[model samples]
Target: MEIILVVSFSYLSGSIPFGLILTKFFGGQDIRKIGSGNIGATNVLRTGNKFLAALTLVLDILKGYIPVIISLQYFPELIQLSCLLAFLGHVFPVW
Candidate 1:
């Protein structure tokens, strides 16, 4: 039950598409159709905002890292699964 909740939350959080939204909001560009066609930070960089790109990268990584870390703190055995779930969220995001 807890594992399901944790993975679901991680997926939802990671699928935020921050890089794409921020780039469009600030630079008025669709980051997804540019560069690697990815909604990640590197694609955000193509939008011409170095600061925003860096921030997005850090935030994205944190999105994955934080969940694993939190899960580890509570249930050490779940650390690996948590990290994998986070990665999946970023790869196949809902948003």
Candidate 2:
């Protein structure tokens, strides 16, 4: 049960569409409609907003890192799985 919680949290955290949200909020543009149609920082960069791209990059990295660190305290055995699932979640987000 604890493992499940950790994994779910990790995945959900990583799945946040930071790039998309920031792009739309600040630039009023759909991130997916520009560049390579990706929701990652690189695509966000194409919106001509360096700050948004940098912020998205940092937030995205933090989402993955924070979950793993939190899991380490209570679910040490799940650290590796949490990291991998977090990445997969970013690639194929539930959102």
* Number of clashes recorded per candidate: 0, 0
Error of 2 at 3 (Å): 1.2
Sliding window of 10 residues with minimal summed lDDT for model 1: 9-18
Which residue runs of candidate 2 sit more than 4 Å off their true CA positions?
none
What C-alpha lDDT, on a 0 to 100 scale, does residue 91 get in candidate 2? Answer: 85
The local lDDT score (0 to 100) that residue 45 gets in candidate 1 is 79
Model 2 C-alpha RMSD to native: 1.0
Ten residues in a row with the worst lDDT in model 2?
2-11
Write down the TM-score of every candidate. Answer: 0.85, 0.93
Hey, what RMSD does candidate 1 come out at? 1.6
In model 1, state the lDDT of residue 25.
84
Model 1 bad stretches (over 4 Å): none
